[model samples]
Target: MPVATPVFDLSHIYKLSPETEDLRVYEKGQIIIEEDNGKLFPPSMTPDMGIGTCLLNERPREWRCNRANVNGAVGAVVIAIQFYRHHNYIANELHELNPCWDDERLYYTARDINIAVFTQIYFYELLPILLGKENMIKHGIISDSDGFRDMYDEDVLPQMTDEYHYALRWFHVIQEADIKMYDNDGYYLNTIPMVNVSLRTGFLPHDENLEKMTQGSFRQYGGGFDHIIDNDVSNKTVSHRLNKIRIKYSCINLT
Candidate 1:
């Protein structure tokens, strides 16, 4: 018997349903798989952690925003550091919850974890203050205790300086401090992640394409942003000079 040709769709290829909503999905019985991308993936663990492109960090889950447990943070960091140190030549870069820290010897997992826990606290909280290292420290922006502070929390955001308002939001999202040492609310002088996109097409339907009525030329069923010709001279188009018209559609409200 000849093998039947497999019909493929999103469901056919992934052995999933058409209505599946999760962006990451695992195999029905597979033990280790990442749902980062939809497919049966092997562990992407590599000697070089792809520093330039894909990023994943092992946060102590304390510097994480919910609660602080230094010991727990140490365990997570030590595992990552040891794993990365042995395999550093392969992976591009690996970062822990804390960056650029100085502590006692990261000897064994026990030592590393202990140091890492305190480092996590200082990095997440004090590091920001240390950046200013001036009058800000006098104002309590930097403190030995990692107790949560409302002064830095993002609850009453939008009113703070643009830098900090954005910084708080960034911290909440990335779980790493975006800006360091905001004493009198001057920016720490760094770039924040903001994606800007602008797209334009140069071709407008040349000479004769618009004269004849086509499904794509009229307002009844035709044209939206780039879907229509830029030089559209029709009365229903956006540039209709003689008709001062306002369109009303139920799905939205037009002013």
Candidate 2:
């Protein structure tokens, strides 16, 4: 059977439909569930709100953020750490620039800029790799001509097609195991199960997990493109299996 072509570019990473309204970001400067410090925490597990209290022995206080628990499998954790670092970095710059600005102002301003930067990279950088830049330009999906082209069409609804949703899942084939950790000074540290790190942000600080993960990101290579998927992915072990079952149940309810 031939698959239907997707009518929309993949924008669901940032935009959510009415059915996924809960995933929408309500705050201007923050991501959907990330805290001011850029660390994500579960709704049920909040650390003391006092200054420096969010950290346990210099590590991010741990809790179960459902997103982290279910779908965070290594790649997601890396992305989360990337964004968290970027957010804090930008916040620091903003704080230095506007000395009079309060914490909330600094946080939100940094978040807004971070999101804009992410969006720009997503379109200009990632889209080119996924869909060739020439092809995107030819299809009017993107413009080759630079400055300020507003291609916004009010007639087209901002909803993703079923084909688009299904197509996005193909990236799973490239996911790798064996997440490596390294220190800031380029020393080899230890490795952990990417799945094990999920829902345990606190551990990112323990034994220098966060610092090493951040450093190792630039130093390591992702799972190679090959004929076989990892056995863990193929088998859907433990927590992953439960996540799949829940997704299956949700799909059944939808149907």
Name the best candidate (by lDDT): 2
- lDDT score for residue 179 of model 2: 66
Q: What TM-score would candidate 1 get against the native?
A: 0.17
Model 1, C-alpha of 231: deviation from truth (Å): 34
lDDT of each residue in 1-255, candidate 2, tens digit only: 222211132122322334432332333334345443454432223345321111212234443333312223334545645654566677667767777887667666776666667766777788898789999888887778767666768795555566665555555455555567887888878776654554344455345566678787778766765655565454443243234322221132223
* Overall lDDT per candidate, in order of appearance: 0.25, 0.51
| lDDT of model 2 at position 145 | 75
Estimate, for each residue in 69-176, the C-alpha lDDT of model 1 and write its tens digit: 111121122233222223221111212422342221112222233334444455455556536645545677555454743344546322224444333322222222
User: What residue runs in model 2 are displaced by over 4 Å at the alpha carbon?
Assistant: 1-44, 47-71, 81-112, 146-156, 240-255
Estimate the lDDT of model 2: 0.51
Candidate 2 pairs with clashing backbones: 204-210
Question: Which regions of candidate 1 are displaced past 4 Å?
Answer: 1-130, 144-165, 168-255
Return the TM-score for each candidate structure. Answer: 0.17, 0.58
